[model samples]
Target: MSSPTSSRAVPPSSPPSTQAQPAGLWPGLGLSAVAALIALGINHAVPTASALLVAIVMGVILTNVRPLPASTAPGLAVAGKRLLRIGIVLLGLQLSLGDILGLGWGMIGVVIAVVVGGLLVTEFVGRLLGVRPAQRSLIGAGFSICGAAAVAGVEGVIEDKHEEDVVTALALVVLFGTLMIPLVPLASTALGMDPRDSGLWAGLSIHEVAQVVAAAGIIGPSALKVGVIVKLARVLMLAPVMVWFGLQLRRRGGQVEGKRPPLVPLFVAGFLAAALLRTTGWLPASVLDPIKMLQTFLLAAAMFALGTGVTASRLKNVGGRPVVLAAVTTLAVAGIAWSGVMFIG
Candidate 1:
């Protein structure tokens, strides 16, 4: 028998084998980075446009236009999963308990009610529409919480194969949320809503933060301020909602390769910690500004990676049930928020 040292000798081809794993990540990462940069440039030119939305659209376009090289898969996977988590953790830094509490008890109650109510109504309507459970939950999370980011967060905890569902949810948010940007402002004006109420409605009803901001901006300066604050409040619910989803999955015996998902994912815990840190007012604008930029870039890159998974054929196969469910959920959320604004006023 050979000696232990000889038996453990490195193979002649081991060096390239070891290097290949990391090397494979560069192409896809580079592609995602490029797409994100283009998205940023477009958003900068059209301030009202959402960079995240543009990134995902570009990704889908590229995917349909041509096939990506196999080498890009590793980096794309990193962008979609690891980078996405890091971006979400950093997202917490944008929120502060102090700011949310400043809205006072009445408006706070309305915000909570909107989120909870929207989720329940969406799930109920989705079931009635014959939407798949996974898609229904994803749509509910996206519409009820913070839009595409919320969908991505819920997608992380779900062990089921639901990539198409995630994409569909994101697409729905973009579609309905975009429509709300113009419609909410016009409706607010026609309804004789004060700037504050208009802001509240936009913040409460709109799906994406960017969409809320656009709608609020169209109303007035005061509307912009209140709208952003209210939207952030909704974002604050993401951590708990993600944990709840994970717990639900565990209760149903959802597992990945025989392993149960953690009750609170590490990234989500990090998100909570980041928010707490923000609450302390320790990080100044000097630090926050760069972190904010980095967070946006990472999230945009992740969105691009996710978009690549979408294709014309897959989208065509998705059918119209999800579209109908999205429309109903959008109406449900807008109605609930509108009523809350009226009641609180």
Candidate 2:
């Protein structure tokens, strides 16, 4: 648990050379932006595959086919960390405290139960299956919360070198999230649940926000509204979960080399503040619309940046274990969420 920087103490008598580091981030940022643009275009045309998924696939393709330049590493890091955090903060604008509270205590309890239960069960199964601890946490977060965003949030706090695990978890999320778009509706119909309950099920179980929207939309407009609000309820859990993980990391002496993140990260704080601002009715639609656009673009770009971290060799090293873990985790979450929906209704 020693700090990463402790071993390589530099002597103060001979300061390091003042050569300025090259501004290499532009290339990576530019590439990520391009990927995001391509994803947006694809989403517009197809309307099934989410832009976030498209961007991640593009990043993986680029990395495997033609290796990105070394100079782009700095920028890619920026996109993965800073841009991801900023995107998460802006995400708050899409939610409001009033809307979440309106769901009533019974519905809120169901959401909390599913999320907490999903995280615990997934992580336990992961451990039993021999997955690494950090990877297990990332996978659990992805399944229990808001897909790639949740994985990114957990990774930021843990500060581990398991970037491949994050990508693996995200890949699984995209896969099942996509599949659920069709599967959920079928299940809802089979169960004979009304549109409202179906929407709640989708919101609780689906991994990504876009995937929830797509699934709920297929049911009906009423379903879509219920699904989105429920999904936001899951999203709201991200902050406290992140703080708990951060505290766990600190307690276990897992702190990274430098300054540790705040107990409640700055991004989470910004997210709460933005949500409160939205509740105030002060944010005009014109401003909110653009912010929403920017939020999506930023998250897309961040996904692409994370994708660049996944090379063929690394995937080969991981083999199929992560995928299996993802599949099991996804099914567990879907079932648990559905059970909650049934019990509540």
Judged by lDDT, which candidate is best?
1
Superposition error at 330 for model 1 (Å)? 0.6
Candidate 1 per-residue lDDT, tens place, 121-219, comes to 878888888888889888988998899888888887776545578778877888899999999999998999999999999999999888898999999
User: Candidate 2, residue 224: CA error in Å?
Assistant: 0.9
Query: Over the stretch 193-287, how does candidate 2's per-residue lDDT look in tens digits?
Result: 99999999999999999899899999999999989998998998888899898888777777643666567788989988888899999999999
**Segments in model 2 whose C-alpha atoms lie over 4 Å from true places:** 1-22
Instruction: Indicate which candidate wins on TM-score.
Output: 1
Deviation in angstroms for 246 in model 2? 0.9
